[model samples]
Target: MSKLEDLKTAVINGKRKDVKTIVPELLESGADPVEMLEQALIPAMSVVGERFKKNEIFVPEMLVSARAMKEAMKIIEPILIEAGVKPEFKALIGTVEGDLHDIGKNLVATMWKGAGFDVVDLGVNVSPAAFVQAIEEHSPHLVGLSALLTTTMPAMRDTVEKIRGAGHDKVKVLIGGAPVTLEFAREIGADGYASDAASAVDAAREILAS
Candidate 1:
């Protein structure tokens, strides 16, 4: 396989060290940062997501691949920015108040970044007021609320309510977590629901496209 293809395979295999080595080599050979992202990093994550959805891979596998892509992005993002290559969309993600879990939220953030979105992670235990403030501040195209406990689900609902209550009609709200469901998302008036990070990317793209 070609070096770019090798980069793709390295990401898919969760080979972080190889990704670190190959990205610089490609850049030194005058590879376009945009091409590297579009051809290798993003596609690698997409394949990982598909395999995850099919149960051929699981969370550990997905995390490692996402991390690999992250390593590649660390080198490429600065070049893209210095070249004025901006991502098409911005996303804000946070774990709701009363919930401390962040594995799922962090995974989604990594996946979204891999998919080429400008992501702003709001961190765990974020309040409705904080979400509203972030909406006002960032004006993100997408907002993801994660809640891992059934007990903390109400905070998720409240965050969505606050977002709408703040009159930010243009932003799309996407919710997910171990305990969150499509039904709950709808009942809470979220724009989309995702079972995992990969599905979150698909849902975010779909919601934004429409």
Candidate 2:
């Protein structure tokens, strides 16, 4: 098989060691870093996302695959930046305050990266103030809030309210996690909701299109 296909298989198989080795070889062999990102790494993650959405793969497997792609990204990102290749869109993602869960948030972040959005991950237990500050600083087209516990739903609501009230009207809020639903998202004034990472990509794209 071709080297690009090998790279894709390495990511799909979660072969981080192979990815680390292959990425440098590809770099030395005149491979375009952006093409490597767009053609191989992202597609592998996109397949992983789809499998996760379909329940064919679970969080553990998804994490493994994402880590492999992340290794490749670590090598490719600097080259892309140095070459003046920037992603066309931006997103800010985080888990709301009082909720320490991050699996869902991390998955969505990976999917966003796969979909070519430059994602800023704010990590777990993000406060409303922090969200507002990030909005002002990043001015991202999309924001994602994750909460694994029902108790943290209120925090998600408060966060969305704070961002909206802060007059960041152009920023679209997206809500997700085990506890967040369409009704809850609507009540909290979120612009979108996705049950899994693959759909999160679709939701973000739709928000961007609108």
Top candidate (lDDT): 1
Q: What are the Cα lDDT values of the candidates? A: 0.92, 0.89
Stretches of candidate 1 off by over 4 Å are none
lDDT of model number 2: 0.89
Model 2: CA > 4 A from native: none
**Model 1 lowest lDDT segment of ten:** 107-116
Tens-digit lDDT string for candidate 2 (125-192): 99999999998899898999999999989999899889989898888888899877889988878998
**Model 1: how far residue 85 lies from native, Å:** 1.0
Candidate 1 lDDT tens digits, 54-171: 8899889888998899899899989999999988899999999999999889988987987889999999999999999998999899999999999999998899999999899899
* Model 2 vs. true fold: TM: 0.89
Give the true-structure RMSD of model 1.
1.7
Model 2: how far residue 90 lies from native, Å: 2.0
